[model samples]
Target: MKTTRLAAVAIIANLAFATGTLAQDKELGEAVTIELNAVKSNEGGCTLTFLVANGHASQIEKVVYETVLFDSAGQVDRLTLFDFGTLPPGRPRVRQFSVPGIACDALSQVLINGAHTCEAPDLTDGACETGLILKTRTKIEVTG
Candidate 1:
């Protein structure tokens, strides 16, 4: 019984080590850049097409982010999630998001609320908001 228990402990330890190293090897990368082209009024509100392009060498599986939209009076109308699932490396993936009850022109500012999960290491502190940048088209930055 003791022998079996010891063997089980050893196996569990090895598995843990392997998994930790694998995560470390993959290496969590940085957040990608967001390109906001144009916002058009849609059925109920407005639709904005944006591109999630690679900002680094690592492959990105998912990007969980939040967006804050300010109305014409600079008041926050709504906050929504912008999850870019499985971004292709070295290729630009265009994604669309619809904001209900909000006009395209009514938006005064759009900010990246937070970076919930980005890259391999996951949960990067302020990586989605403060570290955010607009490479093209939309000049609105992700700050604060």
Candidate 2:
């Protein structure tokens, strides 16, 4: 009877730990939303102007943009990384990045990966800043 009780306790403890880990993973997996306005297709590739507003919490420090371009078939054709600098609390910023080798006709969607790396600001010593990861999905229309 004692052995059975011990086993049950161990199982319960393991389950608690597993639940906590899963929650953390889910938070990290949540996608960030990015709005791309006025996307134009040129002769060579495409140009996109985007803005991120209230995309993160005040605790967030640095965000890294991992962009993946997909074709109409839903196959990933290009992957690009844009490192966005530090973000201040409650401040909105706009940035632009060009996508090369992407044809307007073949373009389907753009995936933005936002990775939050919250650390102490080099200029000032402070407490731990929370980090965030965001992924945005946007559709594109081809115009000849």
Candidate 3:
């Protein structure tokens, strides 16, 4: 009887682990990656087009893309946000943002808000903020 119970418990544990692993894999596969293509310098402001690709198993609804610009002095000069409603699975979306008074060389960092929470990261005591004005690709999971 003891051996039989232990066997049953072991099987249950194995099944649970497998299920968790599969769920994690699915979530990871459903993430969306954003790639910065080009930043055009206009006379009035800067135009940025970021390529966003969704790999989720399901469609993401009501997605908002925001681009926060930081200057060379590490201060936020402009914040431009765009709302791109629904993004179907395996589709690429282009989001544009215009930042006024943002010079090409003066830019130090850019933040692509995927969740749209707009939570400010702690930047105190010489600690670097979450993102800086540089060309980098980051993934924001909109939906699972």
Best by TM-score: 1
Q: After superposing candidate 2, which stretches have Cα over 4 Å from the reference?
A: 1-33, 55-61, 113-138, 141-144
List the candidate 3 regions with Cα displacement exceeding 4 Å.
1-28, 117-144
How high is the CA lDDT of each candidate model? Answer: 0.63, 0.51, 0.52
Residue-wise C-alpha lDDT for candidate 1, range 1-144, written one tens digit per residue: 999999899966754553343234323345456667556789879888776565454556677777788877878888888887766544556678888887787877787767677664443344444445553344333333
By descending TM-score, how would the candidates be arranged?
1, 3, 2
The best-first sequence of candidates by lDDT reads: 1, 3, 2
Q: Name the better of 1 and 3 by TM-score.
A: 1
Expressed as tens digits, the lDDT of each residue in 28-111 for candidate 2 is 322233445446687788877554433334433565656677788988888777555555533434557777777766777776
Alpha carbon deviation, residue 28, candidate 2 (Å): 17
lDDT of 1: 0.63
> Which pairs in model 3 have colliding backbones?
30-56, 108-132, 108-133, 109-132, 109-133
How many clashing residue pairs appear in each of the predictions shown? 1, 5, 5
How many clashes would you count in candidate 1?
1
Best by lDDT: 1
Query: Candidate 1 vs candidate 2: which has greater lDDT?
Result: 1
Better of 2 and 3 by TM-score: 3
